[model samples]
Target: MTTAIRRRGPDADGAWVDTDRGVALGHRRLSIIDLSPGGAQPMESADGRYVIVYNGEIYNFADLRADLEAAGQAPGWRGHSDTEVLLAALSAWGLDRTLAALNGMFAFALWDRAEGRLSLARDRMGEKPLYHGWVGQGEQRTLLFASDLAALHAHPAFRPEIDPASVSQLLRFGHVPDPASVYRGVGKLAPGTRLTLSADGGEDAFVYWDTLSEYARAAGEARFRGDAIEAVDELERLLGNAVLRQSVADVPLGSFLSGGIDSSAVTALLQHNASGPVKSFSIGFSESAYDESPHARAVAAHLGTDHQELIVTPEDALAVIPDLPGIYSEPFADSSQIPTYLVARMAREQVTVALSGDAGDELFAGYNRHVHAHRSWPRLARIPRPLRRLAGRAMTAVSPARWDAAIGPLVARKAVGVGEKMHKAAGVIASRDGDALYATLISVNPDFRELLRHPSEKDGFEGRALEIVAGLPLPDRMMAMDAIHYLPGDILTKVDRAAMAVSLETRVPMLDVDVIRFAWSLPADMKLRDGVSKWPLREMLYRHVPRQLIERPKQGFGVPIHDWLRGPLREWAEGLLFDSAASLDEYFDRPAIAALWQRHLSGAGNHQHRLWPILMFQAWRARS
Candidate 1:
């Protein structure tokens, strides 16, 4: 694993193994802070109570170091590496308190010699990736972990198998939900949680922190902003400090310039703080509609950074898709991961750590669905049940099967689902409003009402998220659901697996726990006001970059999957849906799948929704 990272950033690599204590920690040095060997890891504390292997930048390490010194515990400074400061901080303050003080992106493993235990933790928003697995049985069992799943595959104990429910969910949501990975044996450490393992490999996982619920209960008036001026000013202050802190690397560091508000904001701030040109990288697609390189180039020129860009074709993306199972160590179907991986690979060639603008979307309610669902709520209520049903049937028939294959269907299935949501909301909200609305918005699978009949199915999957928001007021629940669901499951998972696949460490400044708590305390209207999503976040961006550059409609980072399935990927997709050599009977109804495929091939409907998950499952099966 260290070797792979070395290839990505070759400045240094350090490793230490305690055979007596049954622990091993390895680090690939990027030398972002205190570039000397003193920053080396596996880092041990002066008292030898704790040792740590960490991946990420700790923006507030200097401040944290001063705080530790003020507390009357000063270890002689070797170099100004936050890595050493972090290990000492743990020894001085212990894990729980130390974690609370951190304000950067990190996934670290700490071995406590005194306690005879090893603890693994990811940052609050999961900006870093951690994968763990135990192989063999009984006394011979062994636990292995790494920043990416590919490293885990190096162990002989790992196997490849698809989890049926995971396949269903990934296909529906474009990423696997947390606590469950695509792999059968391996599991991802949930964001803000920790796992402690004994020398014997017995392990216990626990949540040390969860910011959403905490913020929901915070006194709102403390950080409350009554208008855009206050919102923008506070955001600018919070984000500028976050960027400044995250920039505390001893080695060369850079930013990912997406030309979007988030990345642009980061780049602008980096330029302002740095004495020399800030390094920046951007990945583009051959499809003009998908390409944001032009925007990135403009932003890079505007910022005067040492900029680099790469234009990847669909063929380029296709080449990487098959390798995903190994890269992710589980089933993850986020198509954007293709570009994310490519970009990270490009960035790693020049810089060790790259900062990103990821959490702004989730924190500020930037998703279009949030807007669409909100708008449809009132309109959906006005239509009478009989009229909705009649309209749905008529709309479903208006576009014939042939027309669907050619022109795509104008089916009211989506509209009907939208209409029925009102009635469903009534039924669900009657029990609890936050729980129901959250459930309604997040369910991406086909009407699983019928699928629920099977005893083997994971029940109430939609309710799982709402359960996190059960007691919160509506505004907080909305933010909490995104934090728990979209942040870790989609955004973090996409960036971590993709970035680490190329051995580049990507940092998310916006996800600092303190920043997240402050954002969550704001009212929902601030997030989505006057039909605009992320209104507060936009105002925040304006404080740094001109608003006009990002004033256009939100163009999400996504692949043209709908078009790809019908274009270059047709044969591969068709084989999975119909002539699939693998036996899918254990998980899917083969005949039903064939029918869905025929429905698409014969122009009955667009089957990409049903097709994507199955294809991914089959691809994984073939690889395994």
Candidate 2:
């Protein structure tokens, strides 16, 4: 099983087992810190009661070590890896305090001989992954888990039953939400949680941290009393410190720069904190609409950093499509995964560790969808539900182009791409209430149930997010949901998988503990001021990078998925839906998929979001 994930850790491999105790631990080491053999795992503690096989860096290990020494809990020293520090901390502080003191990204499993139990834990913000399940039934039932699904699947006892409901969720949300993998009876561990299993077949689970509750607590403490400048100053200092902590690596380190507010700010801060020129990576395309390399290059030049870039062609992207199944090792539908993989591949050629600016959009109100939906919902809600539904039906009754030509100049302030915006609004205009409205706005296909043969019930993290963000203002509520749901499930998963596929490590400093708390305390106006998104991030970044370079409209870091589905990928897609229809026959309604594909092909509607997940699911099924 450990050999299956050799790519995640090319530096070393080890295993520890005690047949009498009925427990085993395996590790594949990436060897980022303490290159000596002393830092290797599966490690044994000084007291010999605890054993741990850990993945990911503990950024606060040095502080923890110091605290232990001060408290007279320190053991004789070993090499300086975070793994050793973690084991020692566990011995001194026990599971709960050691976990609570951690300030990093990780997922780990620890065995306790004294208690005759095993514990699994994940990091606070879900930066890393851990999947677990019972491999069998009766007295033979065995608990199994690993950092990647491929490792778990390689086990002889592994069961690979497809969960149809999760497939329906993939069609709706692009990625399956957490606590539910595509495989039945296997679950991705939730962020800020731990589960303990004992020799008697009893189970216990606990949440060590809670993102939504913590944010609410921080916000309720008090709004920031300072003005914009003070907020920006504090953000820059906190973000710079985060970069410094993550940069403590024995291997080469760099960052991904799209020249957006988030990436540019991280790059600038990293360069400031570095002793020499920081290494930066980016990827570009021929299609200018999706390219950000030119802007990234400009930022790198001004920051005086070593920059690397690749000009990706259509063939390069097409080559990655066939490998997505094996790479992700599960069904995932985010189209940006292609470009993300390309950039990570490029960066791995130069550096072993990379930093990313991912969570800024979730922490601040950076998404136009969230902002526009928040703005438009109130006015639409004032109208009666039936009238709103009627208005939505009338708006989408005609083709978007016909709508544009028919009512293009009627409004006082004509909306850009007025027809597209109107049609999007129509999807949520008739929602039953505010919560339902937000759910519809974020879904790829709000009519997802109609596509499934046995829709059954959702029973995933989707409902958890909606419940958490219940009565806050729409913009903040959406931001909280994105931070809680979309950030870990989609954005962070994309970064982690794409980077780890090639043995490179990526960190997101925007999700730092201090940064998150500060983000929550600032009023929404500070984030989305005067109709501009990420206002505080913009203010902080402008001081380092010229405002001219940083103030452009936000372009998504994604591929031209829609055009490709209709053009380059059409034949490949047909082979899955039409030729190999067995998976669809068993789980989904092939006729609905065929009608949607036909409608997209004929330009009747743009169903790219809907079709992409179906294609991804089919591709994963065919490969796995």
Q: Provide the lDDT at 512 for model 1.
A: 66
User: Which residues of candidate 2, in runs, are more than 4 Å off?
Assistant: 401-421, 459-471
lDDT value, candidate 2, whole model: 0.86
Per-model C-alpha RMSD: 4.6, 2.5
Best by lDDT: 2
TM-score of 1: 0.86
The global Cα lDDT (0 to 1) of model 1 is 0.70
lDDT (10s digit) by residue, model 2, range 1-624: 999999999999999999887788999999899999999899999889899999899987899989989999988888888888899899988999889899899999999989998999999889999999988778778889999999988888897998887888898888888988989999999999999998887889999998777766666665577898999999898888888888899999999998888999999999987889999999999877688889999999999999999999988999999999888888888999999999999999999999999999888888886667556677878899999899889988887656656676885331334565678778778788776776777787777777778885763445665566565677777777777678888999988998999999999898888788888888877787887888888988888999998877667888877778889999999898888554677877889888988987876666777888888889999988
Instruction: Locate the minimum summed-lDDT window of 10 residues in model 2.
Output: 411-420
TM-scores of all candidate predictions against the true structure: 0.86, 0.96
Which candidate number maximizes TM-score? 2
